[model samples]
Target chain A: MISYLLRRGSRVVRIILFISFCNAVLAEVEIYGEASYENRYFVEEGLFGQDKSHSSFTLSPEFYFESEDQKTSFTFKPKIRRDSVDNERNLFDIQDFSLVKVQDSYETRIGIRRDFWGVTETVHRVDIINQTDQVESFDGEDKLGQPMINLSLEREWGTLDLYVLIGFRERTFAGEKGRLRLPFPIDRNSAQYESSAENLRTDFAIRWSQYYQDLELALSHFSGTSREPEFKAALKNNTNLIIPYYEVIDQTGLEVLYIVGGLAFKLEAISRSGQGDRFSAATAGFEYTQVGILSSSLDLGWLFEFNHDDRYKDSPIALGARLTFNDLYDSQILSGVIRNEETGETNVFVEASRRVRNCCRLSFESVYFNEGTNSNSVQKTFEYLKQDDFARFEFIYYLGN
Target chain B: MRKLFKHFLFVSLFIFLNFTNADDFDRGLEIALATDKNFSGFGDSQTNLKMLLKNRKGFVTERKMKMKLLEVPNDGDKSLIVFDSPRDVRGVAVLSYAHKVGSDEQWLYLPALKRVKRVASKNRTGPFLGSEFSLEDLSFQEIEKYTYKYLRDEDLEGKGCYVIKRIPLDPYSGYTKQIVWIDKTDSVILQIHHYDRKSFHLKTQIFKGYKKYLNKFWRPNEIHMINHQTNKTTTLFFEEMTFNTGLSEKDFTQNSLKRSK
Candidate 1:
């Protein structure tokens, strides 16, 4: 085991050396990223066997290099993180490291990267290129980088991108002591795959996006091993376990947005063919903003979004679908306010300073996982998550030049 | 010879009559529009700036950001600002597309969420990130967004200038009116006094250290804004600037905002 760890460690060092050498060779370098520490303290005590609080420290550094003419560039962002509660959650990752070359009307990028596609705020039904880094956040705000070679062509009509993705990365799950988690701890050793080639399968995707006046639209198609895994109950370490089962699937998605006045309407729909019958899902929402609210300099935005998954309307796999489409609530209405205080413009923010989420929210969120206390259903994951609904106060300080 | 003298006298008299007239409102708009037109037609620009914020208590902090502006013909200009320093704001970018006919569209991209949230462009009176500058102050400063009133012609710092009071057409402005001093020699803003919504003097901004870039573009090397009520001040220095950059409309898009360094 020591020799195995040594080999992996040496590989990491070699890659880091190679990347730094490349950056050194390229002169014009721009370095960026942040060092941040955040703690999330649960309001109440642990449920069953969880901790009352969780804290993490992160150092995410990125470097970018481009030529004088800007035709060729290399971008790299390496993240190192440490978590107090869950040892499995602490790790290192290459969030984005890509080499890109731009030609007339076209650009080609090769390496690990991150890509997003979708318009709705509630759920990202159309964004599936990168796997979810589940331990990072409960909102699915973090993503694992995907290894891909992408060629993009810009035409008068729109921009077209074709991607050949390799090195399939599996979605991670929360550890046992984590707050939001499945009923049983997921056993990575028991993972199963539909394809015999398994993790070696290469994925491919193509997307075309266009914006015209008040309307923006994009259509994408992806075919490969699914980033999402299905869990089946199993016996492991004398405890009930949910063994991850990976499957291959094809997904086509369309995202659209239209803006009129101070409001914007967004829709993201996806149709996939995978385990069980064919299914389709969509998240539709609209954001209405009241500018300069109440004769003050504040802006208030009201967001109303609803998600519909045809698979969830069914009986047998409804609860499973809920677990798969975790953050997507059936109906969610959130209102947020943003105010730029005239006093703390520099370093004088008092209690809650420069909050991007700004003011506050009393959101009404409802989702149905299942109506039963069945041990097979992971409905408890969502039930336990309700305890994490919190009102947080944050203080932000700007560091560095 | 007599006819030429008579013609010149009549023309001089006509100019004198309008010069001292009470119709300063019309002249105010003319001066304002002339100032706007002088800075027009430069395709685009890229600038690096360092900002210093100091409170009344003598505490000082610094910030660095990169700004890119692209001029839109027959309309308001579009700009993109990416904050590079201040690790907390690293990778935060804002894209603003100003229009001549309507409210501008501004989008703020937060790197933590990898999401671009829309900001109400009309929320212009509020300070921008605790700085003395507002959304309108950093915007394209389109002439159509305000109504002008010429106050007087005065000599400021030995240079001829026209002082004007401009009222924003948007009612939500934090100030009822802003008095501006435009230098006549170079058509640049020399000073501006911002009033609160209650029509009281709140802050004053001065532009100094002017440098001509690309021979035709005159940009201020340093700008100091002082808040009278709070005794706070923020100063911005344009560390480096380049005009006529080859930036297209694509660089100002939402995708470009996300990709900003």
Candidate 2:
């Protein structure tokens, strides 16, 4: 299977090279590559019933090749990552091969990659995602096998930029089945019982930006449906589970005042359909950043989210701050609090990171879950997590160019 | 008889003025070339240079530099310059021809991985060592790179000088035009103003503290360039300069790049 995949990859590379050569005949060609390595540690508590820590290392490499003529250009880029943790490893790959043709007043490009869309910057970024051979589930026991195709279009007229996107996916499941396979039989024929599923999603967004200015305003809406068999089976068990659902996510935001010696600000708001549904959440946030003495910079941000459901209502607030010294060293601190009225459960968390150098960095994080009672304020009992209670460290180094 | 005599005088005066202007232009070009030749002799046969760079924001960084110059006797007045600076750079060399068909050929060696990479001539305008000086700035350009015009006589730093304007013939050049003040007495360039390709004022380079060598060469011990847009400046200081150290062409080849001391 690996050989077959390699053969397919080579064919794609050959096609890219041929196109690059043709383009180079008319203009100059430049190629470059970069590699980076990262080590991360994770510690989680409360949900899984135990406090466990795991360390992992990941290496990522990206290659870019471009050919440009007087009026036209083509660029091809491929990014690959190898991630390993505790004697297990996997690969993550993403490629963007685009041909851009420019005219006097218009430019167009066709490629398989992420699409930047919408006023909220999230309403219309639907793109094809390949899930086959992808490691799924925390235990790495289940694999998601499927390939998805996504289409998107965007245009700018006057001060408004508009975008739309549609995505379709087909899924198949693979794994060793136990004797009491609740969903299906535990045999090869049962594996054959797996069928292809289709999903359709759409998003619309509008953005207004000023010419030669930093301020921009955008609003967007997204709605989608999932008809995968696995989800359908789960819904069959509980009729309350809805499969063909629609969501109306509205977001409006602004980015203001970007200059060398000035401060900048960004604000965003998100509103969804019904409370407690799959995508029913409302959020508002703003960030401020400025550069100061000796080329040092600082940023601060705050966000608040509200969710309304049949059983309870939830409100969450988060605050973050970052300081950068020169371009090499930086430090960040973040804190968040989530409160549910019905369940009386409040989760609070804090995280921070500091860069030691260009090649190394350190991070610290902690979380405290408090169960509050509405009846008593002074005599309220709560549970909390501490530093020795739950935290991790990470370091990164870039190796080659 | 009187009318003919008067006409002859008028014609003679016009011819004299034109001849003098042409002579002034030729003299200016000669002075510029002579000044450049004298400055090129200030460097050692092979030497290393180090500098501390400070940005406008007060960030400081260190850079180590090495330069080697070779003169070709049999290859039609050719010269080679090799430079190695900070940032894993090794074996970066430039081959210049007093008369090449198009432009000079340059190659850079990456010491970290032990590889020699060729640089395209079209990128001559790119910065060298992250400074205002470009690769093209170091190469010897034939008279064709610019069309020199004598502007007028001027006094610079208590020295009699001829002010000349040079307009680039090649569109790819970084500068649209350059104005140079050349000292007539010592045949040395005192100062230069480099304009952008679009004719916008860009930067000024000032040469000072000249040290006479061998009683024949006048070399500037210091050169400074102030960028107008960025409000930043870079200064190059020459130390331990020597001439006639017997640099040969064999020291400039691709094979010699790796073997350099």
Candidate 3:
């Protein structure tokens, strides 16, 4: 069976390469991709009751095509990842596949695409477009492409975007064998949606963004199935089990940022109402940078942010906090620093694993879960991560960036 | 005989009046403004380039990037620079909205994070991509950004050129002053001498091997900048270039930076 699976994987690779070659030869297309290996070492033996060490390799390729006049363009990107310790944790995703046509001040796009809509880094409370590709990383920076018909109009005042999301994709979770995953495997096949149409439910969103001098502001509203799913208890084979439940939700978001001198202040806030009741969340932060320090061409920067959320879930009090599945850790703060070297285009940064480089980069990062919070909801929700405050060392090698 | 005297008087007066008028607007400022005015009207441009960085020991490294620019009327232009080569930074892009006043607005897109980072303009003088070119050097240099003083006129390889000294108005500027040479015939910049804060000659940038595009814009084939203190050099070679691409304000924006290929 293993050999057969390997053969299938190779065949899939060959087919993709063939298609990529044809695209290169047939049209005005440019290819970009990266292959990297990440070796992560958890400080404890089993943070998620799994392994102490984990390693994964990913190969991502993107094909970008444009007309000679650049009036029309398209981009298709696909990624595949394989974990050394768990075949079940291997994953593949069509990160972005979109065709866009630009007409004067308006542009229209149709297909699967990703959109980001927040300013704060510690927590992204307002960026809610595509479902999180959780299996990709813990930071949730990676996202799955969303199917939509999008229209964006640009004016001197601001940019307005309208989206018709045609289909919903369930979020991916790390397999049970993965260390950074939840305690139990999230059964994607048995997922349920509150909408009768389920995954076929149509959704809509609108956003307006503008920038004036040092300030950036964006506001958006989305009515759709919440990307975050709550678990519903059931009896499977006479044993208690839980399946993911997607709730229809309406969310309004706001983001603001200002830059002055070497300092930047940012904010992201979201208010949502749906199956789980109405709640609000916010994250605010500031980043200050010192340039060319000590007469050298090096930049040193510091970042600090506060994250907050009201754990107001209406999934019924009987279900309790363990299965409510709300993102309410009450309040927490994050702090870190970054160092950039201009001589070699190298950046050595700590705090956010958003840190990536060409040759190689090593990082040590830690985030406190703040388990001893005073709120009742916070205490119950963070019970699982009581001992989760631990440091991690990640070393990545760029096979081809 | 009376008609001849009248004609001579008119001719000499015309010469004297023209000379005074020429000196009316600070000779240095006129030349500086002329240099910028002569190169205007490139509505927008798309350029594929290769940057070669050489260390003092003669070892060389290279990076490939594409630049897209849009000219804004009555304001500075907007530019988006996306790196394509060196594998690691393939999808990295930087968008800059240069202005006639104050610092420019810039954002950087990191493919790994799939996010755009707002970059402060305070570090504009830092080296770009580990090369001799500073991010500020790549921006559209407006006449209002500096104070110019006319120096003298000299011949550079049989070409008569006007020399001028300019001090940056922006406090973040790394240089104390820059001596510039502009070709008298075409008003194109020939060379520049950059001075450090301690009054030391730091670097020299020579623009050579020009090619005229559309019979109006004088595009340099190669820009060579050498660092005197470090004995290092960086050269930029334009490979594929197109101008007046009909790209409007839409293509040079914060959203476009993330979508840029």
Candidate number of the best TM-score: 3
Q: Residue-wise lDDT of candidate 1 within B1-261, one digit each (tens)?
A: 999999999999999997776578788988987777556878899999888888788877676899999998988899999976555566789899887776677888987666666654544555565676776777777888888888889998999999999998765566788999999988889999998877889889999998877777778999999988768888999976888779988777665676677
Candidate number with greatest lDDT: 3
- Give the residue spans of candidate 3 off by over 4 A: A1-28, A47-49, A86-88, A238-240, A312-401, B1-25, B111-114, B154-159, B197-200
Provide fnat values for all models in the order shown.
0.15, 0.00, 0.35
Pairs in steric clash, model 3: A276-A314, A401-B87
Model 1 chain A: worst 10 consecutive residues (lDDT sum): A319-328
**Deviation (Å) of A168 in candidate 3:** 1.7
**Interface RMSD list for the candidates:** 10.2, 14.9, 10.9
lDDT of 1 at B176: 85
In candidate 1 the C-alpha lDDT for residue A226 amounts to: 86
lDDT of each: 0.71, 0.45, 0.74
